[model samples]
Target chain A: MFAPRTNRLAVLARDWLRRAVPRSVRVEWVRLRRLPRWILEAPLMARARVEDPRRDYPICLAWHESPLQRGLFEGETELERGKAINVAIAASRLDGVRVDRFQVLSYHHLVGRPSRRRGFAPGLELHAGEPAVGIGGGCCQVSNMLYLLALRGGMKIVERHRHALDLFPDRARSIPFGLGATVFYNAADLRFENPLPFPVLLRFDVRDGVLRGELRAPEPPDFRVEVYQEGHRFAREPDGWIRENWIRRRFSDLEGNELRDELVAHNRCRVCYEPTSTQTDEESRAAGPR
Target chain B: MLRALVKGAGLVAVARVPGGAAAYRRLTRDVLGTQRGHVEKLRRVVPGYVEIWRQTLERPLEGARIWIHEAGWTAYWPAVCYRLSGRAGAVTNCEGRIHDQYLSRAIAGAIATEIPNDLNDPRRIRRLRALLWARQSDELFRTLEGTLHERCVPTNLPLADASRDLCHSGGVLEHYRPDELAAFARECRRVLKPGAIASHVLDHRDHLWHADKAYPFLGHLALAEPLYQLLHGHRRSLSYHNRLSPEEVVALFEREGFRCLALRRLVLPERIYLDADEAARRGAPGLSRRYLAPRHRAISEADLRTAAAHYLFQKS
Candidate 1:
C-alpha cells in the first residue's frame, strides 16, 4: 500500500527510485548478472527438461489467447516487463509434456521460477497499488492464462490463488475478471488435476505478442462448461479502491440443454484506478465502504 | 547485488568528475541503448498498435488519396508500412503490444480494402493504390516509382485543387515562422479535397528539453529574442524552433478557413520548473516581458502553458 498523497516525501521517493539509475547502467547490470546465473541454475534446469512434443491426442479440451498490450513501448520499465512475459512463457511452455489421468500438473513445477539467471529481464509488478520493477514480473500472466484454460475445461482444481489486486481495465476482456489465478514460485501456485480417463496434452506458446494455449485429450468432455462472472463492483473505500466479482460455472449438455449451475468463487481485489466517468461525486460518496 | 551497486556508483562518480559530463552522457547513452535493444527484441515478438493510431485519427486510413506535408520515409516506417500491410502487426518490435491473441485476428481486417492474400506479403504490396503524396522526392517515399510528387513548394504544391483527401503532419508546422505557417495552411486548404481531413500533432514545448530533461517546456521563453538567437540562433541549432503555442496554432489553422473537428492538448507530466516559477527566479524576465509587450498583445501566459496539442481539422 502506498502512503497517502499528503505524504509528499513518499511520492517523491517513488519517482526518484524509478529514474534513479541511468537506463544504460541498469540494463548493463541485469545482463552482467545473467552471466553467472547460468552456472548456478545448470543442474536444476538440466533436470527440469521439457519433453519432446507429439500431437497424438484427437480431442480439444480448451484454448485461450491473451492478446498483446497497447501503449506498452513508451517507457523503459514497461519494456522490461514485456520481455519478462516472453521469458516466463518460454520457461512455462509444456509443448511436449502430457498430464496423465488423475495427475496434478504443478504450474511452478513445470515452469519453475523465472528469474534473471533464467533469462527473465525486469518486468512491472504491483507494489501497494503502484508499479514497481522486479525480476520475473510478468510470470503470473502465464499462470492466469492456464487457470482460465483449466476453468473452462472443467479440470479438478487442486490449488489456485487469486490476485490480491486487479489493476487493469476491462475494456477488451474475454475471460471474466476474477476468473483467473495469481501465482508466485514455490509459494503461490496454480495446480489442476486431470480427471479424465486418458492423458491430456498441453500446448502453449507466445505467438506474435499473444500467449496462445490449447489443451488436448483423447476425448472431449461429455458436458459443456461455461465460466462467467457476476456481481462485479468497484467500491471507493476510505483507504483506496476495491474491485470484486463472483465467478460461476454452468454445465450443459452438447444439445444446448442446461444441466447444473455452481457458484465457484467470490473475489475481492485492491487496485489503483480512477473511474472518473462512472464514479461521480454523488456515486463515489454513496459507494464508499461502510 | 552490492558489487553491481558499487559499479553503478563508481560509474556515477566518474560522471561527476568535474569535466566528466560528456563522458557520462556517452556512457549513459550506450547503456540505455542496450537496455532498449533487449526490450526491443521482446517488442518484436509482440504485435503492433495501429488501432490507437486509427482511433486518434478518428477513421481507418482506408481509401484516401493522401498528401503529406513532409515525407522523410526512409527512417520511419509507420506510414508506408501501415499502408502496405494495413495491419499494425506488420510493424516490428511493437511489444508491450502485439498482445498476440488480439493481433493475429485483427490483422485480417485492413483499414483499407486490401487483403493480405491479394498480395504475396507486405513487401510485395506496392502502394495504397489509393495514392500517396509528399513534398520531397525521396526514393523511400516512393513505395511505387511514380507515387511521389515533389515538384513545388508546400505552399503551392503541384497537386490539383481539391484533389487530395487528407493532409497530415507531426511536429513539422511548428518549425515554420508565423508567416510561413499561415502560407502553408492556406496552401493546404487550396489543395485538399472538399471536406478533407487535416491532422496535425504539434509539440509546443521548448526543444531544449531534449538536451536537458530538467528544462521546462517553456524554459526558452525566459530568453529575449536577441539572447535566444545569440545562444541557439544558428540554423544548425534551434533557429528552426518556433515559439508559437497551442492557442496560436489553432488560431492560425482556423484563419485559413478550416473547421476544427478535434483539438486538445496532450497531457504531459510537469518535470521542470513551472514557467511563472522559473520567471520569478533570477535572470529570466526577458521572454516574460516580451510576452507582455505591445506587439505580443494577443499571447497570454496560459497560451504558452499548453505544452503540446493535436488538431483534427476539416476544410470548410
Candidate 2:
C-alpha cells in the first residue's frame, strides 16, 4: 500500500530530524527497537540505564507494615483498614533514588478474586465486584508504609495525594491532605526523581502480620528543613452557600530547633445561602438602619 | 386464491372465541383441581420428611442436641428449621469453599443418611459400605486432612452473637481424630447452654486406603496393635482406622459426662453417589469409586444400615 519510494522517506522524517539536531538542543530520544542486540538480550532491560550518575538514578522502593497496620486497625472508628494503607503510601518518601513512578499491586486483584465482602452472590459467579475492590481490600497499609519510609530518606516529593480526612489523631502522623500521594491503578501514580548524586536502597518485610519498610543510602550533608503550618481557612463559594476547609503551606529553613509561633489574620467565610423569606426581614432591617 | 380462502375458513372454524357471558365453570374447576393436587403433594412430602426426622430425633438423644452441618449454601437449614424445635436450635458450618457443589451435596447426604428409611435402597447400601471402607483408608484420610487445613477455617464463630441450645456438626466430626473430636465436643459443650444437646456424625471403619483394602475389623487391629510393630521401619503408622464401636463410643460419651440418649443405625438412599466426584478428587475413595468394582460380595442392606448409623448423645 505504498504510494511510492518517496513516501517511505516521509515516514522516517521524524528520525532524520532528531539526528540533524545538536544533542544539547534536541530532546533525548531513546528507542528500544533501535538498541543493540546485546542490550536487548539482557533480562534487566526494564531498569533505567543512565550514563551520568551525577544526574540520573533509579528511585528506591520500600515496604513496611507495623505502623501501617496500627493506623489501619485503630485509626478510624469504622475500622477502615484499606484507606489507612493508602494514607501510609502518601506519607512515605523515596530514599536513595528519587521515585519517578510508584504503583501498588495487590495479590488478590492479580489473582482475579474479589478482595472484599461488600456485595456478593452465591453460585458459579462468586468473585465479581467493582474494580476498586480487587485484591488488597486493605492493602493500602503496605503502600502507606513505603511512603513514610521514603519521606525519612530525604527524597524530593514530585507527586502525592492525602487522605480524604485526617486519619490519625496525632498531627505528626497525618500527612497533609494536598501534599499526600493518592494512587489508583492506571489512573494516578506516586512519582518523584532523585536530584542527589547517590543511589538509595528500598527494603520491606511483613512479619507476624506487621509491615516494615526501610530506605538505605549514603548520608547527605545536613540541611535544615522546616515544615510550618501557615494557617487554616474556610473558603466560601461565590453563591455564599458552600464552604471548603483548607490549609496553607510555607517552606523555610530552621535557624533553631523551635518553630516560630505567629497568629495570622482570620477571614470569616460567610454562608452563601439563597435570600429566602427569612433573610428578607434581616435585609430590610439593615437597609432601614443605614 | 382458492387455497388462501380455504385456509382462512379453516382458521375461522377453529377459532371458537369464548363467550364470557357463559358460566364455563368446568375450566375453573379443573385448574383448581390441578393446583390442589400440587399443594397436596407438597404437603405430603414435606410432612413425611419432617416425621422421619422427628422419629430419628426420638431415638435417645439423651442430652445430645441435633446439629445440621452443611456447606452453608444448601437449603438444608430451612428444612431442618421447619422440622426442629425453635428453642435453642442452632447450625454450625465447617465450609471451606462457600460455593462448592460437592461439599454441599456430601454434607446434605451425610445429614439425610441419618434417617432410618433411607437405608432401604440397594444402591445406598453399596454407598454406605463404600463410605465406611473409604473413611478407614489411612492414606486417603491424611490427604483429605491436608486439603481441609489449606482450604477451610472457622470464619463465622467469632462473629456469632446467639447462644446455642444444641450443637451439631453433621459430617465434620469424622474429619478429626477421636481425641480432637472429643476436644471439639468438649468445646461445643462449653459454649452450649446448660442442659443442651450435642450430636456428631462420624465414620465407621471398613474401607480402602489407597490400594490397600481394610475392613471394619482393621479398626480394632490398628488401635490395639503397638505402633513400633506396625511401623517397624516406616516414618509413621497407618492410624486413621482408629474407630470405636457403638459400645466404645457410648463409653467415651459417658466418660465425658454425657448421657447417651440414642445411637441407631441409619440407611440412606443411593443419591450419595450421584455427586461423588469432588469428594473422590479430594481422596474420598468411597465417593470416587476408583478402586471399588461392582461385585456380588457387597455388604448386605442390613449390615450397610448398621454401619451407616447415626449416634445421638445428650450433655448431662
Best by lDDT: 1
TM-score of each: 0.38, 0.27
Q: Which ten residues in a row have the lowest lDDT in candidate 1 chain A?
A: A41-50
Give the Å error, residue A136, model 1.
0.8
The runs of at least 3 residues in candidate 2 whose Cα sits more than 4 Å from the true structure, single-residue gaps closed, are A1-290, B1-75, B78-90, B95-97, B100-162, B205-242, B267-305
Candidate 1 chain B, which ten residues in sequence have the lowest lDDT sum? B89-98
User: A1-290 in candidate 1: lDDT tens per residue?
Assistant: 35566588877886886689775465556555644533332322212222443436777788887765544445674655555564446535655457765355777667765676767767766544456667677766677777888778766566788877766556666677787777655556677766444677777777676777777776766678888877667777888878777777776668876654556677887765675556434333433221
What is candidate 1's lDDT per residue for B199-292, written digit by digit as tens? 7766676655544445555555655667655544433332345777666777888999988876655434532223333323321222344544
Error of 1 at A276 (Å): 4.5
Candidate 2, A169: how far from true, in Å?
A: 48
Report, for every candidate in turn, its global Cα lDDT versus the true structure. Answer: 0.55, 0.35
Q: For candidate 1, report its TM-score.
A: 0.38
True contacts kept of 2: 0.00
lDDT of 2 by residue, B14-73 (tens): 333344211122222221211222223333333334443445443432223344443333
